[model samples]
Target: MILETSVVPRDSAEPCADRLVLGEHVLGVADGATKKPWDTGPDGAELAEAVAGHLAATAAGCPAREAVDGATALVRGLLGDAGVGSAVSFCVLHLGRREIWRVGEGRVLLDGLPVPPRPSGERIVAEARALVLRRHLADDVPEATLRADDPGRAAVQELLRALVGLRNRPDPRYGYGALDGQDVPDLFVEVVPVPGGVREVVITTDGYPEPAPTLAEAERLLAQRLARDPLMLDPPETKGKRPAANSFDDRAYLRVAL
Candidate 1:
């Protein structure tokens, strides 16, 4: 049974980089990294759609490895040997194996418990941003002004870009995962078998700081966060508040019943 699913662009002006795919025997969520101005190839939204299409096309009983291999090849084909093919993070469910294959930092919950991954270096950068955000706010900077033009951006953009080099490095300090049509070390891909007792699974993008059990609840939690700390200065600190969007990041949530 399907509970709910949605993918919305941050603002009406831009395309959403997140995607949700439901295949015959599998379904998953894909989140393409936001593109930067220096980015030269197809936008992350297009890449995400391509990857999502590949995921939804997989035949029933296809091995999770083969599915990912195909997606990786597609990404490489699209971006070629570019210096950085910003990739997509995903969480896929293989009904045949009763397994969930997750790459990167997308969130997942079985029953009501979280299936957490190791911390990445994103926090370091998020804190840097929060520091700037708070300082500006203390100086009476309007929240709307911060959203329109992030004064804190220049101070931390370089630090944020540096994290790109750490992708998939397997380093405890900075390594994170993604599917960019390259060889993602096994260390970054997590294949989890759904226990027999587990009856439901929730998969979501990091847009929601804390994923709730239901879509209504998820939206509620997101609204609560946006109202209380739009800057995301608490735990899962992000780059900044919504740049001109409904939420800070594009989001997708999928709940399934076995």
Candidate 2:
């Protein structure tokens, strides 16, 4: 049974780049990567919606690898290589198997214990960006400046560019995976067991670094964090909330009680 669900865009004026699917014997949340306004590619929202649809139609007994492959092939067929770096991260719960399949970066908790994310240089990368944010804050930059026009992004432009290039690459160390119309290495796909006696499962996008079991607590924590660090640089590794935005990134949540 589902206890709660939410899919909200960071900027209400724009389309949400995240998706939630409550499917037969399957539940999922897909967080789409946001692109620069000038970038030319399929919109993240469109890709996420397509993925959600694919997963919903997928048979419950399908293997994890097969599901990922089919999704990848679907995207590749539609967009070809042009959308190589445009990607979406997903977390799915298969009730039939009592398992969870995840790809790319997001947050998931079974009974409040985190399922470790696939390894990457995420920590160091976030630290680098956070350092830039600190420098800007020291200069007395306004919150609006940080939100509307993040000048610090230029400082980490090279790193961000490299991250995009590494998407769906095969290299185990520095490479990562996403539903980006590229071949995803097995190392990047994860299968987590939903063991017995797990009373609750909470899944969310990276927008919420910490996943709370209930929607109320989660919202309270989010509000507290936004007040404390609107730029999302305190702990690092997140895109900052835009001016007039509720959160730094698109957020989706799904909670189930077994």
Candidate 3:
């Protein structure tokens, strides 16, 4: 098998929260959720690394569900009593079977089209952010300037918190699934057979747009989009917190060809 991988951090100074592990017979990718200010324990990067390492170590022998459950338990134990939760979008590929185990927000492309387990959280956050922005549009604040320190941004964050809280309830319209140091009921695992001798798989974090054909193409398209609409304010894509820079999310892309 041939593997091509790429990872980019949102902030140059901070570590990337996405992790990739290629083992003897298993491949794993994990994207940690951004840490909140009030949260405690290790940061997103640390959590993602831990999860990826666990998956790589266990994927060769254990069932995908077991590996994910074990990793979640380990991380939860590490985070003891802090209300701050460490969440991640995780994927494990068993090379021999051409099977995939996916939990949360990452993408898996068999050939070019996305497989099961599409994302569900960011849209809720984006809608809340748009509502906040629309209410405060009269202030004429540039999206780039909407920092956490700013009052407007703070309000948006508050709304986001509320929205997230509501969504996390027992039975909500949208369930934003993640490896959130908790038991996840919506885990996705499937066997994917290659069609007509096609044997390529692309797995990625949500940072890359879905339409791009290849990782390099995704990067190029992202760069062009950021140049045109840095904040996604002119033509919004789901609507979320305004980014400080053009690319404000940690990104990871892994392609495996057999």
Candidate 1 vs candidate 2: the lDDT winner is 2
For all candidates in order, the CA lDDT equals 0.79, 0.81, 0.64
Worst 10 residues of 2 by lDDT: 77-86
Model 3 per-residue lDDT tens digits across residues 1-258 = 646788888767678899886677777578987766555687778888888887777645666667666876877777773224556667767776567777666777877777756445556556555556655556787555543333433545664565345322333345555555656553333334545465787888777655254778878977876677554444443333335533747788888886
Ranking by TM-score: 2, 1, 3
TM-score of each: 0.93, 0.94, 0.82
lDDT of 2: 0.81
Pick the lDDT winner. 2
Tell me which residue pairs clash in candidate 2: none
Please report how far candidate 3 places residue 42 from its true position, in Å: 1.0
Identify the runs in model 1 with alpha carbons over 4 angstroms from their true place: none
List ranges where model 2 is wrong by over 4 Å: 82-85
Query: What is candidate 1's lDDT per residue for 1-258, written digit by digit as tens?
Result: 787887766667878899997887777789988876556677778888999888988887777778777888888889885337577888888777898888887888899789886688878878888888889999999888887777666667777677767776778768877777676667777899999999888888887678877888988998888888776777636555665677788888899988
Model 1, position 225: C-alpha lDDT score: 85
lDDT of 2 at 242: 75
Candidates 1 and 3 compared: the better one by lDDT is 1
